[model samples]
Target: MSGTLNQILNGHLSLYGDLPPIPIGAYDSGLNKTQRQFRRANKISLLEHLATEGWDHFRRQESVATGLDRYHPTKLPTINPGVLTSKYLLLVIDGTTHRAQSLAVTGGWEHVVSCSLANMNSLPNLLRDYSAEWISICHASDILANGALHALAGHLQQAKTNTVMTCDDIIVRQLWNDGLGYEHRQYRSSVSAIRLCTRGGIGGLLTLDYSLFKQCSFAPSYTCLEALRLDVLLQITREPIKTTHCHQALVKHQGSKNPSMPEQGWPRERCPFSDKQLDEIDRIKSQHAKQYFGIEGGLKPNPLQAGCHDLSRPTDESSLVSILIPFRDQVELTSTCVKSIQQNAGKSCNYEIILIDNGSADNSTIEWIKKAIKEDNIQCIRLDEEFNYSRLNNRARQLCKGDFLLFLNNDIEFVSESILDVLLDPFAHPKTVAVGSRLNYPDGSIQHQGVVIIPGERRCVLEPGKHLKEQEVIA
Candidate 1:
């Protein structure tokens, strides 16, 4: 296998003139005509297997001189694998019939446990019985990336007693009609954002102290069990437990390439949660909002779509907001923006507009700024220098008095009266950091729904819903 693989690799390397070919070793045993034919036919599959087994090796050998950074692999966090001991346990949860195949991965582990789909209810008791200090749980379908086990074990050993650690997951799905499975897409794990975006939580892999599991309430029914990790995380948040994500470890999850397939845990393509499940999630979120932010309200159903909340909360009368707008010489646009904000600042919260004059050379713009400063709610600051977006915002932010800051462009004119309320609604949850809105062109065409930065060299910044009709609803 090694000799054949080396020859296949060399053949590919020959195409790139600068690189030297890896020397292929002589075969210890002669290959039959049928074996040689099979090897040639399955070359691609063999290469994929090799890549999966040694992702770290290739990642480390990245060549900056050759401009190979464009294909940059995920940076692996440093970890010592010496932590794995008999006291640590690996638990495999397999819902499929491939039990023996799944158990094969845990061959060398000193302490390993497995639970079938039907026996999932007994997991809590099993944890109590096991005398392990740390426990790592993964699905049967998950294929651990090279060095993932060691990385996980190391993280478990070093993490705090109350910490719950999870690794990154790469979702692979078979797309072709061939019996062999090939992945079309790779998904970065969303487990780290569980605190802010609870709905994005995905199950399959986790490592944590055994005591933490004992404290968390396991799912009693089979339906809830599908999203078991999320339930555990929700319970963990109620306490002082710390949730950590290990980017060094990789877990490959085999899912369906067809979007129509109903996935159980995460909301990958569509809403995976039932009405009852969603209600339960909303109830918990409401409780947390009240407890943490002193905000009282349940999530209202989204009128435009099902399985999502409108995230609207009652107006917080006491909270103050600072709206910062930076402008140069466009007085008309600036005037329209300020006027719209003043007229549309709803009863959601108290607000003040801070207009930053960034070297306005026009007399009309300077005069407008002077007159705008006279208002009690509006403040004007003159920075007659080169414009820096960050510098302008920071200077205004330091002087402004508000619990939250809203950065606005000088050209933005609000058409909706409840814009502030809608934008601030997500902030009701303590963990939400920022909120964004959809922007439209003058012709009633979509400018952008949001900016998405993805892992790539070219076209990293993607604008979804661009050029679409403004009336069209985006999922």
Candidate 2:
């Protein structure tokens, strides 16, 4: 079995290149014979280890001193059926005042204002009239889509007493550009985000049995709700808690206005966390990281800097990059944009600038472009029709010879010398289809972090006013 497991691990490493280890019992549906064998071997090994532990524990226990029980086998403990059907109490925390109001309007569930942890204890008693077997605790800023509450209630009612359920949140940006206007920029939570938050027991929204809450109550020592939430999750982690993820986008999270929370501070209307409270929260996070991940140092902060690369390296001419730019006779802007790319993209990045002229009426612009074609490695394609963005790019793409294609507007200017390399690096991963860079307006205000599609909308929009840090976002 050990040999078989080793072979499987080695096979996975060989097949996937230098990637993370394949988890036990995880097999691709389209796995070949060898891969299937590895998964089966791992599962069998785990079951055998569990059986050994159970046997060892039973043997260590002393037998009862009774004449009738002398020859009989030892009896294992039986589970109580009533424990599986315990009722629940949904505890919604008032994070943002508006979130609670939204939930009330959508869910039509009873609400209470609890100033302290002690006040929460009386909630179950207050809700005796309602026959709920599970409690759902969520923030006020979390808005449940229509029928979300009913779906959650149905899942909790049918789920086993020990299971804890949480659904995915669709993060929606409501305010754009400091109240310039409102738009919905909605994106579903990623699997990695959901796993990290929920597995650590600090998930924002939760639906669990009332019995679990009775075993672990909220800590009153922490003044901040975030701290209390973490404490509760830590306590829950002590037991073998079963987590069930309802993979639907049932909740809509009100996007934070700040680049991050607490650092930029909460909204002016919200209560501020003291310096002392912040220190304690930091301590808790540090302790959890050490205990769970075995790291002496704290977790690394986000928007990590790109690694340095040598710009002096010789150009790999074979690895050609085709830059397609569409223009309708803004010759000055087009010239400036092309010059910036040529200077900053480094001589080592073998690239050709393809200019698609969409009916340029200026004789000087046409002559200047013709001169560029002879002097520089600029490829010009003329279209005597009106400017159509999609059509122009597609026609240019058909003529380009590079392995990697970069679609650029005639007005876009390069900011950094390594912009080309940085953008191209992510393509090494086979799953990555396309990548986009952060766009900023002339005055340094953010124009786009990434585009998001609103529900029931044909066009995609960016989050107004909020400038997002560098991270992977679903486009």
Best by lDDT: 1
- The residue-by-residue lDDT of candidate 2 on 1-475, one tens digit each, is 5765554332222112111122122222223454346546766553242234212322343222111111122221121222222243445564444555556446544542232333455544545555555667655555565545555655565568766676654433332345321112222221121122212223335666656655675444554555555555555654556666655556544544211121111222221235555455555554554455323233322221111011111234467788999998889999889888878886556788899999998988898898888845688999888779999999888888887788999888888777776566434323235656667777665567532122322222322223322121111
Question: Which candidate gets the maximum TM-score versus the true structure?
Answer: 1
Residue 100's lDDT within candidate 2 is 56
Distance from true location, Cα of 162 in model 1, Å: 2.2
- Residue runs of model 2 more than 4 Å from their true location after superposition: 1-301, 304-319, 346-348, 375-377, 425-429, 451-475
Tens digits of per-residue lDDT for model 1, 1-475: 5764544443222112222121111110122344345556766443442333223322454332111222233333333344456666777775443552344343334566666645668777666667877776666655665445676665565667877776555445343346333222222232332232223334335677777777776545433333455455555655556666665436555553112111112221223356666565555545544554344454565453333344555677888889999989999999999988878878666888888989889999888888998999899888877889989999888778988788999889888786788778766554556667778788766686642222321122222245544231211
